[model samples]
Target: MKEQENIIHISNLEIGYPIKGNINNTLFNNINLAGSSGELIALVGKNGIGKSTLLRNISGLQEPLKGQINYFGKLKNSYSRTDFARMVSFVSTEIVNVNNLSVFDLVSLGRFPHTNWLGKLKPEDVNRTARALEMVGMSSFSRKHINEISDGERQRVMIARTLAQDSKIIVLDEPTAFLDLPNKYEIIHLLNKLSKEENKTIIFSTHDLNIAIQEADKIWLMLEDKIAEGAPEDLILNETFNRIFEKSNLKFDKLKGDFKMQKSHHRKIGIYGDGPHFVWTKKALERLNFMVVKENESGQYIKIEKENNLCKWTLIEDKNIKEFSSIYDLSIHLKLQLKN
Candidate 1:
């Protein structure tokens, strides 16, 4: 497969806001990164990190403290505001005051950079706006007032606005901040689809690290001390998350691709089976602070077997066997046994 071309590149970039009198407070420096077309990149970090500031610098909303950024082979600082708007579109977390403006009207605002001084929407502009609304699955609600829609709908509308702008690169700052679980996944899925289908570069800052780990083509992990950028699996394999979120009580589960709080277990449980039932049974046992082992040498063992559509779980101890039809029932039995 051919490698995608780079849309934006940053070398030795320093990012932060300026201080009035004292030295400028810097969050990160010496950053080197590149984003390619048809890619979905997630900027993930803990709160108060510089994910937002880095996005701002890349999108040209603010000047970098030092170093250089190149957008489409041109200097980032060289483009006029209007010219830059044609290359990159930004969506912020700030709620818009939608006083009676319809969704279509809101999306059409993205075309203002290309419009004449009168800001009239040409036929092509109107068509592009409609397409953008459709792209985000909000075409049916194009005529609805922005205030009449839910928070998730508003977020989709904002994304549609960026689409209508026809920029090759799109940047969003915490777009899923106020959304529900399903909506958050939906928005990220939509962005992933758009990046592949539309061949646009989509970068969004998010606190949802799990979703980013699962969905993003590339992850830019910002830590208090450094920044690491790579494919999600590469970063995980390199144990980058472990280093970035180094904590005594936390462990990153490579199998589950999630972080878990360390727990103390007073008992160990042996499990037998090699299917979904066994997997879930192990999970349930672990939740109760029971360590799982493979062999029955521990004397206490749980066996799971599926016959036809029904599954049976049996507990064996001291040459005695007790069976239960469901894992829930088995769990209840274990709780009682542990208490005794």
Candidate 2:
């Protein structure tokens, strides 16, 4: 397959705000990143790491303190406002609660750059707007008022609006913010589909690390001193996440591809089981600060058995043995035993 062309590039970028004369409160610097057509890139960082600021800088909503941003091999400064809008579309995190705006009208607003001086929608513009609504699965709600839709549906409408703009690049700040779990996954998956099917370069900042790792073709990880850009797997293998929360009590689990609290174990317990039951039982025990080991290595142990498709957990300590039908019961029993 032919590789997609690079759509945006950043070099030596420094993002922040000017504090005083000849002084700037730089959030991060020396950033180098690139995005290709048909690529979905996730911008990730801890809270207050300037992820949003960096997004704004690259999207042309804010000026960088230093360095260059190029779009389609031309300096970003060279493009006129309308031309730039035609090439890049930005979606902010703010919720749209307009009481009277219909979904179609909101999405049609994206054609502002392409409309005539009188702001009239041509036949081509109307077709494009309707197509965009279909692309984001919001066609059925075309006549529905914006304030009447659920948050997830509203987010889809926002994305459809960008699609109507028909820009090569889309920049969103926390697109999944305030959405439910299913909605979050749906929104990210929709972005993934759009990037592939429409060949659009989609970039979004997110705190949803797991979903980002799973869905993004590339990731731009923001740190205090520098920004790291690469495939998600490459960043994980290089231990990049270890530095994200260096001063906090959170530790990234490379094997699990997620973060866990810094836990201290006071007791060792052996676990015996197979398949998912064993895996989940071990996870449950570990969450309670139990050090899981071989059954022969510990004085206390838990055994999991399946009978008629129902799971049973048996706990053994010294010469005492007790059985429970659920992990919750076993956990409670263990806690009580510890207190005694």
Candidate 3:
């Protein structure tokens, strides 16, 4: 198999904004990151941590305060405006809801860098635009007006526009920002597919760590002092996630690959069973500020039993024994008992 080529590289980079004369508000510094072709990279961090600034620098939309950005082994400054546009495409978080603009017309705008002065769409350009729409599953909406589609559909159209650009690298700033749960997953999944099938280098900044951890090939985790780059599993195993949220009231759960709130448990409860019922019961107990423990270690216990194709929760607290048909009943009973 051929090796994937590195398409974007940043070395000793500093990103921020100029506040006044000889003074700048640096968001981050000494940042070194790289992305290769056919890879989906997620840029994640707390809010106001420069994820968008870093993306803007990479996309050539904003200049880095100091350091170098290289594209395909060439200096970023070496590419002219048109050449840069042809090499990289950028999608911002802003939603486009222009009335009377057809999806086909919007996607065709991506071909501007390659078109003549009149911005005429040649046969090849039109074909590429159509193909881009089809790639994003927006071919059916091509004739639809931009304002007529939903937000998710509009986002797909924006991506199709970038695809039409046919750039080697694509930078997106919070592409899934205004989307619902399913749309968020769908957008990230679409990006994953594009990176693998189209072999495009895609980097997107997002606050959706769950989806990012699940879908991204690499994660650029922005820390307070530096940027950590690696696979999601690598970051988890090395406890990088723990460090990222150490200052907050959240901790990373290595086993679950997600963050959990640090809550105070007032009582200890043991839960014993097998299968999904046991798992979910434990979760419910934990959410109610109960520390789940081994059966032998706790006086209060909930035993999940299956009988006649139905599940029952048996609570044993001191000498009081009670059975509940559903977890809801068990939870309410426990809550009332603890309250008393």
Candidate 2, residues 1-340: lDDT per residue as tens digits?
2245458889898889999997999888888999999999999998999999988998899999999898987888799999999999999999999889999999999999999898899999999999999998989999999999999999999999999998999999999998999999999999999999999999999999999999999999987678888899999999998778888888989998999888889899999889999988988888888999987999999989899889899998899999999889988988887788
Worst 10 residues of 3 by lDDT: 1-10
Instruction: List ranges where model 3 is wrong by over 4 Å.
Output: 1-6
TM-score of 1: 0.87
Worst 10 residues of 2 by lDDT: 1-10
lDDT ranking of the models = 3, 2, 1
Q: Choose 1 or 3, whichever is better by TM-score.
A: 3
**Candidate 2 clash figure, as a count:** 0
Tens-digit lDDT track for model 1 on 95-175? 986689999999999997889999999999999999999999999999999999999999999999999998999999999
Q: How far off is model 1, as Cα RMSD? A: 2.9
Which pairs of residues collide in candidate 1?
Answer: none
Task: Give TM-scores for every candidate, taking all chains together and pairing residue i with residue i.
Answer: 0.87, 0.95, 0.95
Candidate topping lDDT: 3
Candidate 1: segments with Cα more than 4 A from true spot: 1-6, 305-312, 319-326, 332-340
Q: List clashing residue pairs in candidate 3.
A: none
Candidates 1 and 2 compared: the better one by lDDT is 2
